[model samples]
Target chain A: MKKLLLATCFLMAGSGTLFAQKYMTRTGKISFNATAVHSPEKIDAINNEVANILDAKTGDIVFQVLVKSFKFERELMQEHFNENYMESDKYPKAEFKGNVANVGEVNFSKDGTYNVKVSGKLTIHGVSNDVTVPGTITVKGNALSAKAKFSVVLKDYKIEVASMVADKLAKEATITLESDLTQK
Target chain B: MRKSLLLSVLSLGFVTVSFAQTDSLMNMLNSGAPVKNEPVAATFKATRIIDGSSVENLGAGVLDFRISHRFGDLSQGSQNFFGLDNATTRIGLDYGITKWLMVGLGHSTFNKEDDGFLKIKLLKQKKTGMPITLSYAGSVSVQTTPAPTLPTGDTWLFSNRLYYTNQVLIARKFNDWLSLQLMPTIVHYNLVDSSKFSNNTVAIGIGGRIKVSKRIAITGEYYYRATNADMTYNGQKTYNALSLGIDIETGGHVFQLMFTNSQGLTDRTFIGQTTDSWGKGALHFGFNISRVFTVVKPREFRDTKATSW
Candidate 1:
């Protein structure tokens, strides 16, 4: 009986460590901006309710954002973005899943900021593309913060702007993400 | 030795249980299902598909400027330019006070009536569980035209010129391309010819839209009056209202071109006063143009500088 109790305790401890290695945040922020070349027209939106998870043990990360959650300055632009560009009803969410390319370089136990490279498959508007972007991971006690800024080509995601107003839209949009995750 | 064997087996069970729990947790984290309550979009693009009100409403703080026109009956012949020479037009403005409430006012050339309505959404179809969207709209219209001079009759009361409509719109989007709606409606006329018509008219409005393309849809609507009594004016029997339209969506604008036998643009006139017959080639061509403007910024994007991504 003593031996069996010891074994069960060991197994529980092992699983507890596995759970400790994961961090998550539900209120992450993501924003994107597109600037027109000739026209003064600019389109931008912010999404605050982003779900993000990070596995410190394997250096795996995932991000999920609802396309409809994005809010824009002009309500009309937001409508067009969802209905015309994203077709959000058909594709409601955009997601990213991958790993930290240089996981060994960062020490999760140490309170320090580390520059990292993340490579992942990003799915948007029902299309997926492999993306490699530079990001930062900051560790402060039990809290972890991650951020990344990248540019996405609209055509790569099958988002088309009609020729009539094409000049008012940029070919590429800059996306920025920030998440403060806490250990599970 | 037996006790040691039992301990080993118990240890194995614990290990497997722990492993399974960890695996599931990791899998769930990796496949983070997006936390979203995304409601179905574009069930019907415009507020009105054709002659009947659709299940859609303007977003909060959005203002819609709408212009609707119905030409004279096509039976008037080519000499009248196929009814294009004479037209009854309605100009309206609709505003959304909140996500679930909207108000509208319109002035129609027919009867020189001024109409106003309030629409409230009761239920919204959502991914969570709601299967259909439902809304209620109440409209009041007052005719400004002078009452006809009677040879020997009582004076026309102010209340006699009033008309009211109550409707409940239920709609469902079956797929990306098809949407259907049913509207149970009641139109009340304070002063109706008692011998010819009832004071209250009941109607069932059926409307649907099939998307032909990303920006275009084919829409049709019909309102059937349930009252069996005949509505006659100058020895002409009133017919049910039927309209077929094509919706074209452009950025910030929705244009709908339609053909119908009803010349009235408001529910009171269209449902209770339709005098043209489709079987007699009295179809009238018409069009509705709607333009939306954002009058108030959303609370979060109120700061212009902060809104710049």
Candidate 2:
């Protein structure tokens, strides 16, 4: 009888019972920083992105990348980023479908913070790698906030760090994303 | 293409239309359909809504300074001077046409006494969330005559060029800083010399705009002929030359500096009269200055905004 009850309970908590949520923001920001000086200062280009979240189920979330939204402030950096680092002209969109585990009465409508894990295939610069990033999402009624920090090896993307400026660009890039999301 | 023009018209039927130089140049030139309340490209974004040549908001206007110096004057030196290259310089002005157009007027101390033209954005900005910029530009002016040569027959000459360009932003948020743009063009010359190189021809150009930071952007563009553009005389073809240039934008102005194998910004002059060799191309340093004018100078700009430009 106990086994029968557990089986019935599992069926009740299937994907059908999983609530979906959405968040959006135009001002979402994704930034990166690299250090290279006049002496032995050959460094690779660094870039980042902050996209919006679509209808995401409790167990998994999704985002649509603003392909042309990527920015590079330096001429050399911008050029190298395109020709060598991220072949944006070929693969323009990046998607992430990750899950957030562990939840107990987590009110997305209430003003509170929740620690979560983001795991998904991040496609960028013509390569996609699975990633599990530690992040947080906060909510205050309809107001939403999200933040995450992660690092990736540029080589994973087939990015050929130019031998000329590789020193400036660390093989490992530190990335950060922060945004104030609004629920429709 | 009429299709592009029609598309622009169609877009305007829906809403409306931007400039600056490097990332600024790319962003302003590329951003196409204005998504309501979207963020302006990185820099030189106006504060007002620009609708079909009408302004609902007036953003900041800048004063740009450019000094361009070509290596030689064929007129001043003649056949002897034609082959003997040196450098000449000039300054000019450019203003945003709309969100998608930019117009420019400039003068030089060499062959082109004064010249002006207009450029229209074709595609949308890559970083501002749009991809590609297809623009069209047509310019006309008389080639200058060095002293003693006198302003003879070709004084009021005219030349028109139609050019198309596309810009794409790579990776990074102000970090990677990269972009590549290509231009295909057709130049029509009012006066074509009997020489083989003097005829109007369809050429190709390639340019790159890179931003090193929020305040400075570096850009380089070159024009080359797909067919033989050299004057073939007595079994000799004057080598086809190419132009190389760089631009920097700051505050409200952009400064362009360059070294071109060809001194002429026109089709005929650069194609035929080039004195530079394959590897021994002449170094011509030059620049252009751009300034903005308003039917009604912003209330605050009336007095203090007078640019040193």
Candidate 3:
């Protein structure tokens, strides 16, 4: 009788976790524009291999991206961004760990869009900073989609721009992200 | 009593599992991730290590304008301004036809020669599995100078001025700081100065680049001729080519300063006809300036977003 009760306790704990809703996407898209206002050439890149996961019960969210996976309009620029700026060999990944502040206001069962405030620690080039951004979460049937736009100062991440290209590369980078996730 | 103790321990394990769930989201996302076969980039900063071709190639749609200048032999003493009195210059234009293929044309003042070459990349090293990068370079040089005066009844044909060279460049980047290359080269001469020397000269070149800083590197190369090592031209014995150089990289430009015993820029003259020996301090100070420009933009810069990814 004691062993049977212990087994029931274990199943209850496991089922509690199994019932928590989680959404994930491996093909999330993240793009950044660092073009200076006076620069003629566009200094922008996009990375489509972003991995993101959201836990609905806890409002916990995470995003991970390989720094070298960002593609630029010029291959040489991509090489410089990897070798010089990001030093991808030393710091290969950029990540964000955060939570949705207003997740309680959203109705996951209903087909509607809700505005959210996401606050997290964003890491890039081996440096981390706390950031908060406004985002939108849309729920339709069994699908969940997220979209956000924000800006990050390059100096905060210790990404140095050489004086030769100082006029071309912007001091702040505007980042945009979009993901279509499925419940798991 | 033992069953009660086991149950307590099992319950403690379940308590820890609840805490692990909050932190395992990143781990869950990474689980079953596909291993990527990413090709290594920037094995060497420039396409040329020292005097020979390196496994590095320019990206497609890029053009490089290269200027190579060699002063006179330093052994000429103060009378020749430490060998700066005479200079041999070669101007070259190299273009990347594709990511794997590059073509070049050059004109050297020393031999009044015009040369054209094609470089093709065969295999590239990957972050894993692959060990080496390989490329093939072939060139043909035509001497445009007037024919030399010959003995009576000696004939000089236009074919005699043509020389062909082929090389297989094999290289490996062992780490971030070190890269080494081996070049097996063959140069065919239509005419030779003497019968003792063969028309086809085989040589092996070994080169290395050591990065000292982000923008500077030390480079060196040595070529040993397997044929006609004992051959003499104009009473001067031939010697192997040895060069040491430094590469300084700025945006859009790579300036290379070197000291070498070979005077010619092409393979035929440098490999087969090098008469100056490093032992005699017969080195020529030289520098090669390379400037690159992007001629075509990648897909990301285009008006349409048609990429599959």
Candidate 4:
């Protein structure tokens, strides 16, 4: 009976650690800007319903966003972004699956901000590309917050800019992401 | 026995820990199903599905300048240059007052008719659960044509020149490629030509849009008047209005080219007073041009320079 009790306690502790290894948030914020230098209209959009998950043990990070969720300054832009650029109906989601390169340097239990390097496969508009981004992760109690900004060539994702709006839209888009997550 | 039990427990814990490490990061989020009750969007590309009001409404603060042109009967052939010689045009401005409400004003050259309408969205369709979007549209058209000279010396009141049309539009977007709508409509004329015919006409309109590509679609609309089916207007027999069009979207503009049996543009004209019959080859080649301008920036992007996040 003593041995059985010890075994059960050991199993419980192992599962508890596994549970604490992951952090997640459904309401992550991600925004992007693709306006050209002399464009008349500002071409920017934001999505607040991004889903993000970070596994502290494995340093794995994942982000998934619905293409239709991105809201633009002009409703027409929003429609064009979905129907023309992203083809939201055909490919409804943009996803990133990657890992933190410096996971061993930061302590997940400590409350501090740590700069990290992340590499991932980003899939947009039914196309996937490998990307690396530099970011910061702040650990506070059981909560973790992350912020990152990166630029991607629109052509890399098969997003085409029509000739009529080529001067208005930049070839590269700057994306900024911020997420607050709690242990799950 | 105790040692064996300990060994099994240790192995079980090791197995689970290894399993956790191998679980792909993307799969973790996928375990939880996606969001629900999200409102569906872009059910129809433009505000009109040919001749009737579609279930779509302009976003708040957007203004659309619409021009509709219809030529005379195509059966007129070379003498009339395939109906190009005669044309009726309506120029309108539609403004979105709120997310759910919109208003429009226009003047048509057909009868020197001036028209205004109000459309309100009552229920929006959802991506998963909700099946249909419902909207109500009410319009008034007044003909400014000279009042007829009455033999009895009766003065024509201003109300006598007015006509009203009320419609309930129910639409469903089944997929990315197909969408359909049904409009149950009522048109009331303040004055009628004959006492035997009722002043109010009841109609049912059916419309659809089929996407041919990302920027092009095929649209069709038909209105069947149940009341006064045999009524005549301007010495012509009335017939059901039928229109078939192709919509081409180029950024901020939507160009619609169509062949319709009705020359009147407003709801009262097209739904209640369409007298040209398709069987007689009285099809009019028409087109509608819609251009939108963003009058107000979205609240989210109003402070574009500020880092609100």
* Residue A167 displacement (Å), model 4: 3.8
The candidate scoring highest on TM-score is: 4
lDDT (tens digit, per residue) of candidate 4 on B84-158: 999999999999999999999999998999999999999999977779999999999999999888879688899
TM-score-superior candidate, 2 or 4? 4
Most accurate candidate by lDDT: 4
Ranking by TM-score: 4, 1, 3, 2
Error (Å) of candidate 1 at residue B160 is 2.4
**How do the candidates rank by DockQ, highest first?**
4, 1, 3, 2
Query: Which parts of model 3 have CA positions greater than 4 angstroms off?
Result: A1-20, B1-22, B77-81, B148-155, B232-236, B304-309
Give candidate 4 misplaced runs (Cα > 4 Å). Answer: A109-112, A140-142, B18-34, B78-80, B305-309
Question: Which docking class does model 2 fall in?
Answer: incorrect
lDDT of 3 by residue, B1-309 (tens): 777686777767666655544358888877845567777888887888876788888788888899999899999999999899988888999999899999999999978999999899999999888899999999999999998899999988999899999999999999888999999999898877788778888999999999897778999999888876676655688898999999987656789999999888887778877888899999999999988776765655567453312
Which prediction has the highest DockQ against the true structure? 4
* Candidate 2 segments whose C-alpha is farther than 4 A from its true place: A1-17, A20-29, A34-58, A72-84, A104-110, A163-172, A179-184, B1-99, B103-114, B122-135, B140-268, B271-309
The C-alpha RMSD in Å for every predicted model, in order, reads 3.8, 16.6, 3.9, 3.1
DockQ of all models, two decimals each: 0.40, 0.03, 0.38, 0.43
State interface RMSD in Å for all models. Answer: 4.4, 20.5, 5.2, 4.6
Model 4, residue pairs in steric clash? none
